[model samples]
Target: MFIEYLTNLLGTVYKVPGTIDPEKSFLELEVDSLSLAELGAQLADDLGIEVAEEDLSSTTTVAELAGLLESRGADIPA
Candidate 1:
């Protein structure tokens, strides 16, 4: 669930069409630090989870970010 949500959010942040690949790194996605910060804010606001920009920066991929959000207590649908 979080993966799907993150994928959608990443697409919005990156202004890209189609689904974002979970295995692709942020660098490969061409995400800059400013985008990371914006993504972090959006995650916190949308998920009600305190995701620091540094934490988001540390995440290598969308899947890794989903794992981090899961660890931080984001809801997982079954």
Candidate 2:
């Protein structure tokens, strides 16, 4: 589920090639900031939650974003 979510979040740039481990950096996949914001908004809308723009500014990795989501009560699907 997380992988699917990530694939969609990543759009056409990066193909998430492995499990959605919360330790990897999205930057490593080449997902730029604009794409990241789009991904974040999509996540926020899909999950019916408010993902603050500040949160995106503060995060530099997929793990950190996942942690932020978790902190915001988003269920991290296995």
Candidate 3:
């Protein structure tokens, strides 16, 4: 669920390779710091919960991020 949402959030960017794989690292996916900040805001707005960028950086995959959201009790679409 989170992988799909995150994939849609990321949209598309040239020079980035691979699909939004659950196992792929965000850093390896070419997600920049600015994008991370934007993602933080988007998550807060959409989930009604805010998470620190530094906290997010510890995770390396879409699946991991989904787990983070789960751990925080954030909403995840079915």
Write model 1 residue lDDT over 2-78, tens digit each, in one string.
88887876776567556688888787777888888888877777778887666777347888898898888887433
Best by TM-score: 1
Give the clashing residue pairs of candidate 2, or none. Answer: none
Residues 1-78 of candidate 3 have per-residue lDDT tens digits of 677777766766323455677787778777877777777887898898887877667246778887788888887644
Predicted candidate 2 versus true structure: per-residue lDDT over 5-69, tens digit per residue:
55555554445555544455666665567766777777776775677766665235666666666
How good is model 1 by TM-score?
0.80
lDDT ranking, best first: 1, 3, 2
Model 1 Cα RMSD, 1 decimal: 2.8
Using alpha carbons, what is the TM-score of model 3?
A: 0.77
Clashing residue pairs for model 1: none
TM-score per prediction, in order, is 0.80, 0.59, 0.77
